[model samples]
Target chain A: MPFKAINILLLPLLLLGVMVGVWSYIALKIPGFPTPSEVWSELFVVLSDPLYNNGAGDQGIALQLGNSLARVFGGFAIAIAVGVPVGLLIGMSKSAYTAFNPYIQILKPVSPLAWLPLALFVFKEVNTTAIFVIFITSIWPIIINTALGVRSVSEDYLNVARVLQLTPFEKVFQIILPVAVPFIFTGMRLSLGIAWLVIVAAEMLTGGVGIGFWIWDEYNNLNYAHIIIGIILIGVIGYILDTVMGLIADFFDYRKRGRV
Target chain B: MSLKTFLKIDHVDKVFPLGGGKEYVALRDVELEIRENEIVSIIGHSGCGKSTILNLIAGLDTISKGTILLENKHILSPGPERAVVFQNHSLLPWLTVYQNIEMAVKKVLGSTLSASEIRDHVMKYISMVNLDHAKDKYPGEISGGMKQRVGIARALSIQPKVLLMDEPFGALDSLTRANLQDHLMRIQMQTGNTVIIITHDVDEAVLLSDRVIMMTNGPEATIGEILDVNLPRPRKRLELQHNEEYLRCREAIIEFLYSKFAKDDE
Candidate 1:
């Protein structure tokens, strides 16, 4: 067990070393490929004054992250508000599922960015358009997962509800919701991840003050090192988001409580 | 004994639609009249439709023909008057044992009782099953036997007219099963509640019931024979192990299941 544990810590570090070594060799060969050391220094430069605000188009890293987060959250919240009820209705009713299933199947496979042109044309504002894209992309997972969660409720639990003569409202709140919560949270987590992924691309396309736009802007100025820094930041943030979401999902999941 | 007909399952039939205009007859012309405070068990082979009978009585399933009546009131859909303890002890995993019982108590007795009164009612049932120590624990935290006990407590807490259990202890180990059987017997003695249990175990049927309704094999299973267990109350398992009446009842059920309508597949 100790040897296995040691390998867990050692393996990632070994891989990271190899990656840096390859990058340094490539940087030396090419003129400006931004070696690991260059990105490391660029990270410090970016982090030094992350909250600074110069203007609308020019802001610090933290402010850019904050703007992106606000949009993702805004779109994410709307998705939950709309998706959960729709999911429940479809899940509980045969007729509703029959009606909604075809549209969901058709719309789910379409890329979030595919809606970019239409959204941009209708909204006219870059921020609204970006948020709209996030909303559309994120909502599918929420609806699908919530419906799956609702469908996953055991017949035994529903029988218990019926035998107890629970009102329709009571059945939903006491039986259905409690059973479906873990699934709903799972959906939310997936939706948030999708929303985060979409927000970056949406910002890049729409031209705004976001991490995605910041990376694109750096590319325009030929700041290759800064782009690498932006990529690292996005990866780290996404990892953190997923971790936090997972923890929250586990918290709501009854199966995780104490099943031996 | 009053000999009052507390629950009547008269000429009931359950036909399940198997699509393509085909149907499966699970139960046919099943008739039973349970006395008030009588402990009746329906014993059968795996596919004898014993559970289907229990479901019909609990009003959890529709009767394709005939009717089920409780105290002369026609039973249609599931109601609090008939509570079922499922084989898997289907306690909501999210809630603690105390909370699980409380949810049922609150739902059924909420209109009649205050919040504090509801707490007392829930705690009372929790103690009846001797699970007060583990009441605060969630269903997932408990052992299988303990979960079944909680299932019993939840069913009884509602003060149903008839308590229906579908192979309630069939999932537990032998020792755990014995323990729950003892618990159920003790609870039944205290409350004198009318109970109908569905089980495959021969000894369980004889030991627990005043009447054992032996069901025939399926493809349209019906009551093959009904053996009367006239053994005296407060029947101890150890004592009943050697009792002549207990041996007779157990043998009668075993004969019906294994000799007459033995299911080869299961």
Candidate 2:
């Protein structure tokens, strides 16, 4: 067990060392690209007063990240509110599923960025358009996964509900929701991931006060080290979001409880 | 002693659609009359439609061509009056043992009984199944036998007129199966609840039932023979090992399943 624990720490550190070696080589070749030490110094500077606001475009890294998060969450919350009920409606009835499935299939694979121009024209505002793009990117998984969760409810559980003569409302709350919650969380997790992924690109296109926009602004100003720092920050924050989502999903999952 | 006919199944047929203008007949001309407070076991090989019969009675499945009446009331849809103990011990995995039983109690008796009465009612059945220690434990935490005990407890807690158990102990190991069988017998004796159990186990049928209803193999299955298990109640597994009636009942089921209507593929 102790050996396994050592390997867990050692193996990743070994990979990181190899990656930095490759990165440093690339930086030397590229001339303007930041080396590992340069990016490390920039990270310290960026982390040092993350919430400073020096007008709209010159906000601190934390403020930029906070704005991106606000837009992503705004879109994500709306997607959940709309997606869950629609998914449940489609899940419980064959007619509803038949009506909606074709459109879902057609629309799901279309890129969220593809909708940006239309959203920009419709909303006539940058933040609204960014949030709208995040919504588009995040909604498909929520609807599809939530529906999958409802369909995955066992016949045995439904039989118990029927035998008890549970009212439709009681059945949905006491039986269906409990069974579907884990699935809904799975959807939400996926939705949040896509939402985060799209927010960066959306902010870049919209010229907004967000992490994506800041990264682009740094690139334009030729402060290449800050771009690398931004990449690391985004990666770390996305990892944290995914980890938190996973923990929440496990909490609601009945299969995870008491069985290892 | 003459007993009142509590539940009746008349001329039932179950046919499944085979997609392309064809159908598969699962059961045909299925008939049964279960007495009040009596325990009946429907035993057969796999695909014998014993479960279909139970499903029909429980009103979980619609009858193709027949009527099922519990106390002369037509069984149209599933209700709290006919609670089922499923083969998989279908206790809601999310709810604890107490809460699982409590959900049924609250739903069935919620209007008639107050909150305190409901709590007492749930506790009564949980104790009846001897799962007091595991009351707060979730279904996934307990052993298979204990889960089935909770399943039985939940079914009984609803105060159903007929308890329908579809292969309730089939999933458990033999030792656990025996333990649960003993638990079931004790509970049934105390409550005097009418139970119709679907089983493929010949020994289980003879041991737990007042009458073992043997079913023929399907493509149109029906009750083949009804063997009377006249062995006295509070039947201990050890004592029944050498009892004449017990052996006779076991032999009849084996003979019916193996000799008269055995499945060639099996």
Candidate 3:
């Protein structure tokens, strides 16, 4: 084989070896930290009976993961429903953007963790509070990116709309939305990542059946192996979510036509 | 030719604001009258505001002074009656060539025609521009010349009262440009639509236009000369190369651009 092809095949293996070596060194130094073998065994035992249910508050890893996923998707769907239209309006109208921009700017930077206390106080329910945090955390990128996308629609396309005498509704549906799809998808991709990040943190605070809570429970029991498994699970799930989002974005991407 | 004026530009001036309470004058006292079924080409050097004049007529830009009248009515904003073939061939990249034309046809004629009728109408224009084979192809998949053909088809599908072309073939290679020019001549002959083309090519102005409106160099550009091309219709590109009248018309435009209004750098 050529040197370049051999390098490509070997590079990933080398990186994996370095990661395992560093992890093993940390496990040895920290004393309580689970080693790679310990975590692998725990992962296998956990996977063998994933959907087991001892009772309420004590369930399998699958149940915790399902709960977390449900909250994330619910919050994400609501955010998209509200954010996209609001963004379209803000982008299409200069006066609306000017009027609403200050409020968006002020509210956007507040952390989702910061909203958790207020949400818990108001909703008084762990599940609703967790979902609220996800909603608030994921909404800003969608709205801001969508607004920017709508605003950046090419003048050439809008000129075509104007020349065609397209109605305001037609302008949005036909030209603005289609042209802005890629940018909106970019925003959605960012928002989904944020949603996943926020859900784990929110679930940890709310003391619920979620991956975040699972990690906290494992930590409380001093089961270091399970904690390591939870971390790996969260990482894998987040990767899967991002990959799915990317595939959907690629499917709708008009700009990548000839290049793809 | 009939004497009735279909479109009139009277004493028009365009001033673009350059911030800090200053403005740049692009066009001044640009007056012209276009008759029904006439092909008028506006040719000038860069920055001569030939495009400004075309935009004013298309109602794509606002005139600082004077008025543009189409069929004795003020042209205030762009409407379906005036369709433009943009310089870069602005085919929506997401839409296929067929959908691009279908969009224009559906918007203007959808209320009058059934779905099948609309499809047939769009296909007629697609074939007229010789893009039937590539109708299903997206703009990104097509060549520059084919994209321009889609632009032309999209513009004509609307059945506009006047078709406006802004350097439609300027971005293509010489060969593709010549091919499109021939296609345009044939299309114009078949439809008899009033056309106002903006171009920098002298031969393009002579071969396609009934009258070429030559603009002087800018700071404030106005029509410098109007040369009438008395060549017969259905003119062939091969035959026009040897035709004395075509050569004389082409030379007149060349002399105007190089000698009368040549830039200091050129």
Q: What lDDT does the true structure give each of the candidates?
A: 0.90, 0.91, 0.91
Per-residue lDDT of B179-217 in model 2, one digit per residue for the tens?
999998999899888999999998899999999999999
- Per-model TM against the reference: 0.96, 0.95, 0.95
Model 3 lDDT per residue over A45-70, tens place: 99988899887678899999999999
The number of the candidate with the highest DockQ is 1
Candidate 1's residue-wise lDDT over B166-202, tens digit each? 9999989999999999999999999989999999888
Colliding pairs, model 1: none
Worst 10 residues of 2 chain A by lDDT: A251-260
lDDT of 1 by residue, A142-210 (tens): 899888988988999999999988888998888898878888998999888888888888888888799
Please give the lDDT score at residue A3 for candidate 2: 75
Candidate 2: which pairs clash? none
Sort order, TM-score high to low? 1, 3, 2
For candidate 3, the per-residue lDDT at B221 reads: 94
